[model samples]
Target: MRTLLSNIKVQVNPKIYIKDPETSVLGRKIIQESIILIDEIGFDSFTFKKLGDRIGSNESSVYRYFENKHKLLVYLSSWYWSWMEYRIVFATANIADPSEKLRKAITLVTEKIEDDATTDYIDESVLNRIIIAEFTKTFLTKEVDLENKEGFFLIYKRVVNRIVDIITEISPDFPFPKSFASGIVEGSLHQHFIKDHFKTITDCNDDVSPTDFYLHLATFITKQP
Candidate 1:
């Protein structure tokens, strides 16, 4: 998989950024530091000026890459999902059994993430935390419909549909592939967050991960008549 992942480029929608962050050093720093800063302080508290101070660059420099923090969050979310889709494709590529492939896909989306050393500037693990905590802010707005039309969420939708394809392959007779796939992807994030903070509400804990729960559901869902 390393060979496949080695050549991978995480492409975010062009509408999400004024300039591609991967093209320049300052842009990369803006992305790298913004992830750490947003993770350190919640999105409600994050500001370009504060990020500028953190990176020793003026706020204008940050704006060169993104129009606002919200767009930056979307960009990060897009990149993370694009990266994840890359992993899902490779991880499930050789599996002959539909159930095993479905389980592998479930595990990739639900399990805790670790930093990918190959991507030097982006810490995917940190990005995953941001996605879990702040991703809703990107679309939970009045402008979501317009932005969705502009395809800001295309990468994320593609990730969900990839799982939907696998679900259909396994459960040709099953209904609700889109809803089921989306629930597994987005629901896992909720499970992980609740397990850490709202502990009593979730069965996921130290020994039992969101991955374990979703794997069981994926297996059960595939067997449906």
Candidate 2:
């Protein structure tokens, strides 16, 4: 599975960038180093100038691939979702039970992300940190509606829809599969964030595993009401 995934290229939305970052060595450096820098500092403080300094390139070179940091963020977020969808497909393949499939999906979303060597350029663990820490900024802006119309959120929507399909298969009468899917994904991220930064706000302590909490939520939500 790792070998198969290594050969796969997760495509980002073309509209999010000025040039395809994966096509050039310098462009890929911008992406690889930006993830590291953003994780080290944050999205608000990160800039193409800082990125150029880190990658030993000029600011204009980075700008060639991305118009600005926001577009780069959207590109990174889209890439992460695309990679996650790939993982879900590979992990749940050949599974005959919807309940088991749902469980696997929940675990995949909630569990701690380890570094995936399959993707040599982009570090999955660091990218996961960025997604958890700063991904909402990609769409929470005033331009989100316009971007939505442009299909900027397609990969994320596709991931949620994929899980929703499994959910509806498990409980055909489920009325809020989409809500449940989105909630589980976003909720898992929230719980992790809370656990890391604001422990008082959530019950996600050392004894209470996020995987268990999310699996319980999925079971309860899918049960006949």
Candidate 3:
């Protein structure tokens, strides 16, 4: 109970709960704190024991809420993707013009990627690389059997398909398939995640930010014949 309240204190405002907040249900608090601690410390360093310690609980107590660290990470990842999907859906909903929708899609996604608050959870650079690698392995592979891929890939698949839909709408006249155009968008997005590495292999001026790269790419895609 002590641990649960401790976590809530960190993640949520105390004014919301008036009395006996410290003795609240354990399950809600553990997950809440797990998320908070993970965001503060990051996945690589975040452990059940560490979380428990921070929350004034034991490792065993933490396990009662999450079976393991991987389980917690899966939950966190799902949470993030859910937020991503919501924003993507909301951003594209009203835009009837395919070109505008495509640009908005790119802009919204890039903004999410560049969001500074997210840095509290994980190093954006590392997080982007991990996301891209997982996306490629789970959704971008030659394997068509969705059942064969891990469950984590499902969220990525949905996001990619959303992008594909927008691309198809914008480039109905383009020669390539929908998936091919989607792949281009996905590849460019992934590249923005780790654009720093590209500088080592090729010349990138110091002034070139990921947003700059994305704008150029967006313009190029918009002007596609």
Candidate 4:
């Protein structure tokens, strides 16, 4: 079976290759089902057996892909960044303007969170906690180095740098440093995930969308005293 898996053609065109295509596809399906379960049952109650049942597989079969829950959560966490990269890149690829690219970046980042289906199955408070504890914090580890061109944050960083390069083309006086700009974007998404809290605890309006929050931030940054 390992040999057969090895011989299988993953990408018809060698230019569009994926490492361990069969395993990766299976891993993706597992992660998706896991998210659904995590939403329905809450992360504390979600289990591999439940995930396997949802995917029409036995628990051992699930184990063949993910050794345990921790490993599975890592993949799921990684997928969030990966998916974010895909969305931002697709949204901004055609635009030649740096500011417009930034706008699209903010839009995609915010809308992605607001549009998340997990909101339906999971409580907002619990989901926010999971995202903050797991997904948001996932960005800070030494694993940042493990992120190649494949992962979301790194790819997103590249996109930001490219935009910064363009902004530098337009105005060197602009104070939007690359790392700072990326942080602003990250913080924007982070804030959006906790918008309800922001409204309750701070001066924010209830109608604030991710894009609106980002636009306000962008304006503030560009208008610094």
Q: Please give, for residues 4-107, the per-residue lDDT of candidate 1 as tens digits.
A: 68787877889899999999999999999999999999899999999999999899999889999899999999989999999999899899988888999999
How big is the positional error of residue 13 in model 3, measured in Å on the Cα after superposition? 28
By TM-score, who's the top model here? 1
lDDT of 3: 0.54
TM-score quality measure for candidate 2: 0.97
User: Which 10-residue window of candidate 2 scores lowest in summed lDDT?
Assistant: 216-225
State candidate 3's TM-score. 0.61
Q: Rate the local accuracy (lDDT) of all candidates.
A: 0.91, 0.89, 0.54, 0.54
lDDT of 4 at 26: 60
lDDT of 3 by residue, 37-127 (tens): 6556656687878877877878887665555665455444444455456666766788888778877766655543543342233334434
Rank by TM-score, descending? 1, 2, 4, 3
Candidate 1 vs candidate 3, lDDT winner: 1
lDDT, model 4: 0.54
Q: Which ten residues in a row have the lowest lDDT in candidate 1?
A: 216-225
lDDT of 2 by residue, 14-83 (tens): 9999999999888888889999999999999999999999998889988899989999999999999998
